[model samples]
Target chain A: MKQENRQRLAGAAAGLVNGLFGGGGGTVLLPVLTRELEGRHAFAVCVAAMLPMCAVSAAAGMWNAPPDLWQAAPCLAGGLLGGILGGLTFGRVPVGLLRKAAGAFMVYGGVRYLL
Target chain B: MKEAILTFLCALVAGTLSAWGVGGGTLLLLALTLLLDVEQRQAQTLNLLFFLPAAGAALFFHRRNGELDTAAVRRTAIPGALAALVGAGAAMLLDVDLLRRPFGLFLLYAGGTLLFSRGKGFSNQRGEEAPPTKKTQ
Candidate 1:
């Protein structure tokens, strides 16, 4: 497939996931983007693309959310700091180790959810 | 107070992962739903909202490092945004359990792939193979 077409499909898929799941666009975007662009560029593209997608999805869901959702403000604040930290350390950290840790966490999450 | 602190810590990890472009939302969702005992739909809503700031911060860092691809961002953003609208609508109509099971399965698939995959797919700024791609399946 053409690069343009692949990108479109990937974008659409990522958007859909972001909308449905609230913010997992990167999970869908990473593989497709990796195949379409260079590795680092692909990661950048995923990050760039997710910002808008998350904004739109959050807006769409805002009216439906319960008031209790505000309780998450602390989490959101922490997440902001984490994002800054992650961004600053992006190239400095061992990508492989981070990936492994992320993978382990995902697995733990999955199993926890399943049972 | 303790719960608030825990929430902050979880969000911090999620935010970092989001900045790293590794799907922090998934982790956030898991923490909220499984650990904190939030409802699935509500957890998802918070995850989306939490993403805004996290993504913004990450974008700032990525741009500073010259990692962003302007052309690619332009091409993907609109289409992705539109599709996200459709997805959000669907999620609203779907049952809570229906969303939870698939999300769990997806996490498993994605996590397993990341753990075992060789570090040959992605390249760093130096153009050397850096690590495997971190996308969820």
Candidate 2:
């Protein structure tokens, strides 16, 4: 497949995941982009692309959300701080460790939902 | 108070994951749905909202480090954005329970891939030798 076609497909896939699930587009994009781009570069592109995708998806689906501002506020606040921290520590932490942690979290989430 | 604390902590974890350039929203969704007993639809909604700031922050850092490819961004953003709207509409129409089971299975699949694969996809932070590059025609 042509490079342009590949990028478009990756983008569409990323967008679909983002809009459908409300997030996780980057995870989907990372592998696809990695085939054409460098590892960090692929990640960067995924991150940048995700911003607009998330925004559009969120706006489209905002009406579906239950009115629960009080419940959401704390999580949002904590997430902001966590983002800042994660940004600050981005390349500082060991990638292996982070990957394991993320994997563990995903496994736990999947099992929890399954049961 | 306890609920508030848990919410904050979960969001923090979610944010950190987002910053790592993975899907922090999945973790956030899991936290909200399982830990907080939030309805599946509501948790998904909150995950989308939470994604914005976290992604913005992560992008800022990635940009500062000169990691983002502007040309690629331009090519992908519009198509991706349009598709996202369609996807969101589809999700809104789907039954919540139906969505949940498949979503869980997906998470498991994704997690298993992450755990077992030796793919160099997520090792961005390590200063190890870069993976062999493929020349794009």
Candidate 3:
């Protein structure tokens, strides 16, 4: 497929997934984009493109309902800590190891979902 | 090429799963590393970036449906966003390969848990087969 066509299709797919499921589509989308594009740039572009959609989906979830501030505080704090730590720690780690870990996680998650 | 199409298709699936609260980031990482031949760090970083917007949209949708706990957002997102920024910066500096092994392991564990726990009350929604509990009992 042409670049423009591929881009268009990808966008359409992202929108459809976001609209239907809220925010689950990108997990699948990223891999598809990487495989199809055959390059980090394409993968990066796909990730960049989905940013707006992700924001929109999250906003959709938060639009009407208000979380209990107290209850969420810890989670938010933890998420923040986790993000920072994960980001930083990941860098020091071996890429091969991470890939293996990812594969393992998928197997586990897939099994969990299926079973 | 075959590679390009495959990556695009994978992202498409990842996006859908993200909506249901299964973080698309991890899935993206898996796809990139296992299928697309992308570097593990690249995949991990990309996964983080991809998830931001999807997560944002889901939060918005939940808000519209009265599912978002605003108080939670204030406490969690505020901190989480800040941490994400720091994390992103750190991710920029680290060796891409270092994190791949554990990340893979994590996916394995999570996927396994989900599969094994099927038909259980662990999920937020109670299954039909679950026996009814009696307040009277």
**Top DockQ prediction, candidate number:** 2
Worst 10 residues of 1 chain B by lDDT: B128-137
Q: Please list the C-alpha lDDT of all candidates, in the order they appear.
A: 0.76, 0.75, 0.41
What global local distance difference test value does model 2 have?
0.75
Candidate 2, residues A51-115, lDDT tens digits: the string is 89988887775787753777778767877788788888876766565666676788888877677
Q: Over all chains combined, what TM-score does candidate 3 have?
A: 0.46
Predicted model with the maximum TM-score: 2
Question: How is the predicted docking of candidate 3 categorized under the CAPRI scheme?
Answer: incorrect
**What interface RMSD, in Å and to 1 decimal, does model 2 have?**
2.2
By lDDT, the better pick of 1 and 3 is 1
For model 3 chain B, give the 10-residue run with minimal summed lDDT. Answer: B128-137
> What does candidate 3's lDDT look like per residue over A4-62, in tens digits?
44445555554444432333234334443433332222223343455555454444334
DockQ, per model, reads 0.59, 0.64, 0.05
User: Fnat for model 1?
Assistant: 0.71
Question: Local error of candidate 2 at B84, Å?
Answer: 1.3
**Runs of candidate 2 exceeding 4 Å displacement:** B119-121, B129-132, B135-137
lDDT of 1 at B11: 90
